[model samples]
Target chain A: MSSLDLRNLKINVGGKPIVKDFSLTVPKGEVHALMGPNGSGKSTLAKALAGHEDYEIVGGEAFLNGQNILEMETDEISRAGLFMAFQYPSEIPGVSIANFIRAALTARLAENEELDAAQYYRRLYEKMDLLKIDRKFTARSVNEGFSGGEKKRCEILQMAMLQPQIAIMDETDSGLDIDALRIVSEGVNTMRGPNLGILLITHYQRLLEYIVPDRVHVMWDGRIVRSGGKNLALELEEKGYDWVKEEVAAV
Target chain B: MPATIEKETSSESIAIDRDIGNFKYKEDYSYDAGTGLSEKTVEYISNVKNEEEWVRDFRLKALKIFESKPTPTHWASKDLENIDYSKIRYYLSKGQQPSRTWDEVPDDVKETFERLGIPEQERKFLAGVEAQFDSEAAYSNMKTKLAEEGVIFVGSTEGLKEHPEIFRKFFGKVIPTGDNKFSALNSAVFSGGSFIYVPPGVHVKQPLQAYFRINAENFGQFERTLIIADEGSEVTYMEGCTAPKFETTTLHSAVVELVAMKGARIQYITVQNWSENVFNLVTKRGMAMEDATIKWIDCNIGSRLTMKYPGVILKGRGARGEVLSIALANDGQHQDTGAKMIHAANDTTSNIIAKSISVGTGRSSYRGLVQMPKHLKNCKNNTECDALLINTNSRTDTYPAINVRGDGNSVQHEASVSKVSAEQIFYMQQRGLSEAQAMSLAVNGFVNDLIREFPMEYSVELKRLIDLQMEGSVG
Candidate 1:
């Protein structure tokens, strides 16, 4: 029952429907891959689930661990254990990465409670060592001038520190090379456990080769038209996306 | 002077949005100049203080200059016309000389400084402290060790009375009365600011601080501060000001003069947080001699209109000047501030870095000047001004005039204006921060480089004040 369940979610951008009649359920202890071509409403679904103001959820019920998320504020939804790794992260010029992560974690604390700096740095250093990030990065501004690979790795580092129950990684492999992709996937795999549920949204099948998914769902025209096991990803990679469009049309 | 005009009770106290530095206690003043400015008013103040004959003549002369000069409106904001000189009480005092110990201060005055946490700060880090209420300092104290080392840290009144030789020589020398209209006005009716002088080769280990509090409505607080660092001496001086929120407008005008002798250095820092109904106009300038350095670190927030541009005149060979400033303008506020550096000597150098933030309908302007005359050789100047606008309605402007002549002199100027994009706010919000927190974080980040230049104690307090100003700024 610990899962993210979406029922008939409809989203609009600037009053134009972009996500129509979408439904998915990714239970805990599982990794689900949502793959589609460009402009297939994959990103829309991710943004709408994160409660972005621009992505209006006209009608839907998004429950995270049986609590409705649609009615909550953006930050409230985040504190409710839902993490969204952005495709293009913002550059906060003067905020160091260490401070940013500390603020995020501090937000999760109860009133009259303070964060322990020693323990926090210890865990942060451990995670950084695992991800191959230098210790000096803690002092640098967050994503101010980071390379694409470094930006993706920072996202994973944030995810590791936050320890969210559910995560939605949108195009995590868009601008990464083979080495960067491998490093990012390794960081993600370290957090994969029975307590975490991941919704990996990517267009290419190459990312699935690193962190294999339990299920593959093909989204077309705003809704999922095909669902199968992990091999469905390789099959779709072998057959072009046009084949899925034709198959959906014929059906 | 006319009979002491009773205070008109504010129909309703302006709702203060923040809990910090917004409370005021009832006023029971022993001397009030009764809501006007005239020769009689000036004479009344001089007579009450029993000032020297020369000082009294100086005040009369400055008063004539103040009346002759017109309000500066050629290029400044139109808000200058709103100040009615006849309606403002020129001075108010509790009539007690500045106490050397907090126990001797009146209860209400003591409670005011206690709430502002001034005495706590004095004990923790400051070597000397001065607390000014209205037109006179309620408490002024310096460590015995510093006073034993031939350092003089006292209120201006005592300095002028006891050490006339040094005080009179440099009182209005750095900033002459005719320098500007506000300077002339301040020279006529100034009171309650600090006077510090360090002997040759004596460096005060800790900073000396002054706190100015305006407790009454419809009053003008004109404080004149003068600091002279003797040859090879070093000192750091800091000041802070705040007033309560009221429906009517209040005025605060001050003139600060600094003199850094040969090989000496002086750092002057200020953080003023007047209520939104107060108009703060100040003139601060320093003179650096051969091989000397002068630096000004200023931050302005929580005022209706603030026009302060601290300047330094490099008058000797190899002198240096620097100004690092941060300003935040909230709704219905205008922060017009910048710096000025005049290189009158060979091989002089100056640097200016200013950052401002405009929230809601607030507007911030940076007007700077850097001049190197033809006679100066190998002089260098660098100026940078950056502005951040929070809402679409927020505004910012920059006006930098650089006049560099001669073959070896060089000048560099750069400016930028940016807005907090929706994406940046949303990005921080997704990390579990409220909209207001996110906005404050971004603003703090924008001024992070400059804030680091402040003293450690003040940097923390500055960040907290910024957070309070940003509480209701965002949706």
Candidate 2:
């Protein structure tokens, strides 16, 4: 019965407001899609929710499972069951993907508790296989010199491993081809269950074809102006975002 | 938990100079052999060790040269100028002879070595252990199998007395006393260091180790070591050093000379963690004959100032040399370490990779030289030096010299200096690691390539050391 509630959240970057008065509620077993054109504050909202240091919350309140998350450190926020998949993942050279994920998992365990190596590897290999990643990917450095598609797959792999309560994917389909997008979508679909809430941010309706979101919200000018069922994504895709801007201007 | 708490409580009262008496050799050795460049002090040392006339004259000549030469002014730190040579004790050794068994060693010296993890490593896997307390080796032992195979492992003093033929042949040929001011000083009053000799065609599978402990104040420890690998023989040597902290500075000027004969291989590894009050200046060099190989793996962790450059001379055809070095400089420490490679013959190759990290106002510098002679055709050399500054107050410098005279020689040099950026820390923090933990991971990642070259146990200890350095790096 986990949920994330964002109440009238406002976010700014570089002294300019990006997300203004944004509100969203994602309960367990629900998948929400944030649809917008470029520069529509969708990524800013995701980053703000993840407690990124650069995205200053000018006025906002974010909660994870009834616990206020804005006051926690970024790492604490992450350990509190919030995970963000970056549009451009960082390349940590010489740090193996296995070690990095193991460290994150290790941080979550009780101080005196130890992880079973065999079971851990077993789970890791299963996740990698589900993502279609090669077994050798475990030894490779995290996102270092990886292709765009490979980076996205790695992000999904991490989400599968950490199994956070709320997973925010920021433009997860950007630079991904049809094959990669389908694979990444399938991996996410496999992890969707009663205890997980997902917020997928994307610029186009193409990703929606595979993920099949339960709810769609159109963000325009730092605010979610429209919210509806999945039909909203197809309607918005048929007509360009200019139509929405024109309608808003007429109002 | 009780042991850990006891250790913590004991560490609180452990001043830098509290363990001076742990240097048992200082207690029994008479300090009357004062710091004088006279024939008498040399004669006293020679008489005390019962050395032959040739060895005694060698010391006298070295002493004369040491007195005439002035300390170098251009290289190294100016703090070395304050070393009061007149006030330093030359040599100090316990009255007992070098023991082959750990039980025969004095209790104080044995306890110091035990605390340093020497006995544990020896009992577990070491092929031999030579523990030097103060100025002389208190205990020296090698596996009986190695002795039966004609592998000579003993103190330099014992080697001079027993195997003078082999000792006299290659004593100062690689690193002469005139090579540096510190080398000259070491030549004059050098006491106890390991002397290893591997017979022709015999390969020693395990690594021999030497542990040096300096436990007395104002006492200079000058240990000279020599290793000769005969034709087709292979051997590896490891050395670790630690000294008690003292209010007054102590001088440690050691000289190590190695010779690898035709088709032989020699590897030398040194891990030194001296206290902040000690000046560690060492000169180590090796000569590689036809088709021979030599490697120097060095890690410098703690010292007020350290100036050490392990050099290799490729004197025969198809010879090869390599140096892998890592230095970590904490507060008030200066690690000036690098390598030197000289290609004197055709078809020789050499490589140098040096990595250093500086934290908390510490400074580390890489000064390297690679030279290929004009007549040496088909020679190749690659030099890479990188430094990582962990804090705003820390600094790093690189000074590399590459000389290639022949057209057929290929020489490449690359150097870079980078500091840990705030964005990197933020990015790592976003992945669920604390600021301090992020800093440690980044630093470890920075040196991961070089660290993988170390043994598994040493790599683990190095990571722990890096973690300790990163503990207070962040608020």
Candidate 3:
């Protein structure tokens, strides 16, 4: 009943049309993999859905649980149960991870409610332990001078803390080695449940071997051209995006 | 139909406090030295205080110097031309002796300090406290144990009358009366500042604090502070300043001097939050003897135009000097501040790090001077100045003069100007923070490292004030 539904979404970046006639539905309790090669507009869709000012939604209807999110602002969309894990997370110097997360959490509370420090730290430590992150990482500035793997892990850490209903992770597996990829996939799997829906965007089939999405959608140019089950990933891996390009051309 | 996620067990929200220190109270003063500046005004102040002939002569001579100097329009801001000396009330006081206890203080003055939370701060972490209202000190007190340990902390008026011998020795030695135009103005009608003297080998553990409050409209508060640390002594002194919002312009010109003897250490900290209609021009400097150390930590916020550059003269060999400062200039305000370091002896070292943020149309400038003569050997100096501009209309400037002419002496200067990037704000916005909150967080991060150098309580207060200033900075 609860889902992220996109119908005929049109997007433009800097007055240049990038995504035209895009549609998808990711229901609660399911993981959908949006697979595409370079410049297929996978990342643009994620940024536009999150209300980035640079990505202008020229024509679209994005509904999250029957509430249209295209009319909301960036922070409002976030507060309305949407989260985005960036491809290249920003480096905010001198702002500790603990304080940044705390500020974000504080923004969601009612006006007069005060945060309890003791319980917050206990839960933060629990999440950090679950992700195999060192406890000292909380005191360091957010994403400043972090390794590629560490930055991705920090993104997942925030996703776990914010606990949004629907999440769009763009290129979370890039720039990570094999061990890091396995660890990150484990963290994501640990957070998956009937209450959460994830739209995982990636260019590689290697990532699907770990997370094992229930559905896979292949994008071409600016639209989803093919859709199938988990084994379709194996078919695409065996052939390649070039084969899909030929198939779409024939259609 | 999104599922209800469990709430995080924390709840800390950013609240805006625009007028935390901008409130004021009215008081009927028994002594007012009328408006305008003249020899008669200076003489009237000295005659009322019953100062000796020598002090009165000193004030009269300094008044002449103040009259002779030009408005300094050539180098400083053009805003200096707007200050009308003839319209400002030079002196105001209740004419009551500074009470040693809060109960003995007059009711109105006591309520003013109480509203400012002076007594509460004094009880928590201060060794001594002095509360100055307008032109005179209302209350001055210290712990008995510190008094027994030979620590002298009292108002300047009492210091001049009771301990003339020691007070007169170094009163204007570090910063001379004719050093600058504002210094001359302060020397002519100075009142209500602290006078401290620490004996040899006496280490005052806690900080000695003084609170300067400006409550009168169109009034000038001139406070003179002199601190002398005898050989091998150490002391930390902090002073906070605030003024109420007034339609007319107010003037605050104070002169502070320090003398640190051989192997002595003196640390001075200042947090000034004047209203938008006040001009804060202050002269603060110190002298460091052989193996002595002097450090200044200054934070300037909420002033229309502030010109203060705390300096140190390394007179003896192996002396050290450092200055750490933070300045924030909001709409209709200008924060012009920096540091000066003079290395006169061999093996001397100095460090200066200044960070400023300019919001709206506010302007902030960093003006610095560092000199190491060719005669000095093995001297080192490091200077860093960073500025952050919040809006397109905001402005910042840096002027640094370094003159080091020795073979083995080394100097390093680094200056940077940055704007909070749009990408950074967008990244934070995706996490549910409003644009203003994100800007405040970014501004706080820019100055976070510098603020860690401040004391715990002051740092907390400074952060709250900064948050308040950034409230409407963005749409």
Clashing pairs in 1: none
Interface RMSD of 1: 0.6
**Which DockQ value does candidate 3 get?**
0.82
Evaluate model 1 with DockQ and give the value. 0.87
Q: Please report how far candidate 3 places residue A160 from its true position, in Å.
A: 1.3
- Among these predictions, the greatest DockQ belongs to 1
What do the candidate models score in CA lDDT, each in turn?
0.92, 0.86, 0.91
RMSD of 2: 3.7
| B35-112 per-residue lDDT for model 2 (tens digits) | 644677778778888888887888888888888887775766888898888777777777537888888887767776
lDDT (10s digit) by residue, model 2, range A1-251: 54899889989998999998999998878999998888999988877777778889989788999999989988898888888888988877778889888877887888789888899999999998888889998898888899999999988888899999999999999999999999999999999999899999999999999999999998999988889999999999989898888877898
Error of 1 at A1 (Å): 1.3
| Top-scoring candidate (lDDT) | 1
TM-score of chain B taken alone, every candidate: 0.96, 0.93, 0.95
Off by over 4 Å in 3: B1-16
| Sort order, lDDT high to low | 1, 3, 2
CA RMSD per model (angstroms): 3.1, 3.7, 5.9
